[model samples]
Target: MDTLSSTVQAWAGSAFAAVFRGIKVVRPQRPIHPKGIQLVGTMQRDDGERQPSGIPWLDTAGTNRVEARLSRSLGLPDAFPDILGLAVRFTEQDRLSDMLLATTGPTGIGRFVLRLRRDAAAAVFSSMMPYKSDTGPVLIAARTIESPGKLPVDPAAFRSLLGGESWTLELHHATPLGAWTRFGTLTLKLAKHAEDTAERFDPVLNPLPTAGTYGWTKRLREPSYAVARGRG
Candidate 1:
């Protein structure tokens, strides 16, 4: 996007951020996705030799401890459909990093569509926004691959499942209009005292290694992230 457009978006986003900050002030909790469960996992990143994502982290093969959180966007009742989110944090090249994903379509035009599902494990989780890479731009995506059954939306039930069973997800990278290419695998289980985990994931502030920030996409997000982090 052009600088002028980014500036305009920044202004509008800041206004929205102010409004959200006020809500958080009143409730003193997450501005969105207030209910969630923490997960601990291992991320096995594979170098995509065939379709390199142009991001060093994904292009380099390695394994890292991963921390993740799953939540309902609206904190809706367990039986109802609501947008779902997956927030992942890890270390890359010794620096803390994060990737925040939400339910979205998996292909072509659908990739732009935000989807809602009652079962968190059944929906595709996407970056929702693309990252500027050396190869141009790319989106990261994940979907449960070897789940035992449909995972409920309730944080309580979800935590129970996480305790006894391991959940696996295939990680992929794709251009906005291109096909997805596998780059990693994530296996998650419940962490000790996960219910008390209060870690925050912020891609805008703690972006993935070797990914471009301060670009058009980040401009659209910085305001809200700043406000949410109590920095604005």
Candidate 2:
């Protein structure tokens, strides 16, 4: 972006962060995922046959213990129309790698522009948000093995859709590298508590190999995270 646009975005991001902080003073426990369940799982990287992409996190093959959380974006009660979310966090060699996806389309740094039912079987989750990669701007995406079906509004069906099966999740490299490259397979095993309500998910804390938040991501997401953390 040019200087003028960049300046405007920075101002806007600060303003949004301020607004979020103001809200937190009143409702400190309110998180982006107000209503959700936590799970324990594993992320197994694909075999080393893939070419190196210069990003250390993606250029290797191995399985790591993962902590995942599933939730309705609005934190609404069950059976309501809300966006579904999957936040995965894992550690490799004592470093943390975090990725967040939602039941929204790929290719935007905006949020809630499109509202889709939280359907598990038919759900398509994208990094929806973008990141500034060492290679350039990129997003991640994942879907279930089952074919798309009728949208289910119930929580039980939604939980079954995600927890019931092993699914493939991918990291989409920017244009020159390619789109939708295999990242890993996520196999969630059991339900667990997140323990700390104050700890919210932030992509900025991502591992070095896959860390970056471009202009749009910062303007649109950082403020909310700041607000959630009472740092705004």
Candidate 3:
């Protein structure tokens, strides 16, 4: 049994290596300091047109969410502390437009709003505070003209990028310590816009049904009852 198990493990590893050969393994390069924060957000063009560059627009009606993890070393000096995670979501109508999410030392400072021109490039970053506050100021760490890239259509690549695997790799490489640290993976899923119904009134957006609700029995039973009751 042991020999069989080892052989299977070896075969699986070899298969994975072959499949992923020449594919770059994406992972965070830094230990995600308490002063450093990662930001991920989706933006859409207002005209309902997608730019030639590959960036997809997030639905305007749904809230855009952001997350960050911050951490600091403790008395044990050189070791890295456990990470604390923070997150926030804002919609287009929210007062916090043009804002950059910031994290400093296990805390989330309020977002800083900036002027951004359409078709222009921009970068948002979190900065450390010189003074103490519940939430500190995050300055512009870097900026550039917005040149979007093409969206990945491949299911495997897309899934790998969206999964938390990259973040997990970075955490594992970091030296564990006693101090409090911030660490978390941020994710963004774009929502589709709501449509107006035939009555000219907007219908409440229905949440996506769960897999359990999609059983064949449930689908068949519900329709049969409606038909029998003359309610279809």
Candidate 1 has an lDDT of 0.83
Candidates, ranked, lDDT:
1, 2, 3
Greater-TM-score candidate between 1 and 3: 1
By lDDT, the best candidate is 1
TM-score of each: 0.92, 0.75, 0.19
Instruction: Name the weakest run of 10 consecutive residues (lDDT summed) in model 1.
Output: 191-200
Question: For model 2, how does the per-residue alpha-carbon lDDT over 88-127 read when each residue is reduced to its tens digit?
Answer: 8887777777778788654333332445565644666766
What are the clashing pairs of model 1?
Answer: none
Q: Flag the better candidate by lDDT, 1 or 2.
A: 1
lDDT of 3 by residue, 133-200 (tens): 12321122222222233212222332334343222110000111122122222233322231111110
Q: Which lDDT value does model 3 have at 190? A: 23
- The worst-scoring run of ten residues by lDDT in candidate 2 lies at 168-177
For candidate 1, write residues 149-196 as lDDT tens digits: 888878777776665788999999999999999998999887777473
Report how far off residue 116 is in candidate 3 (Å). Answer: 38
Better of 1 and 3 by lDDT: 1
TM-score of 2: 0.75
Off by over 4 Å in 2: 18-27, 51-54, 106-114, 146-178, 192-198, 207-210
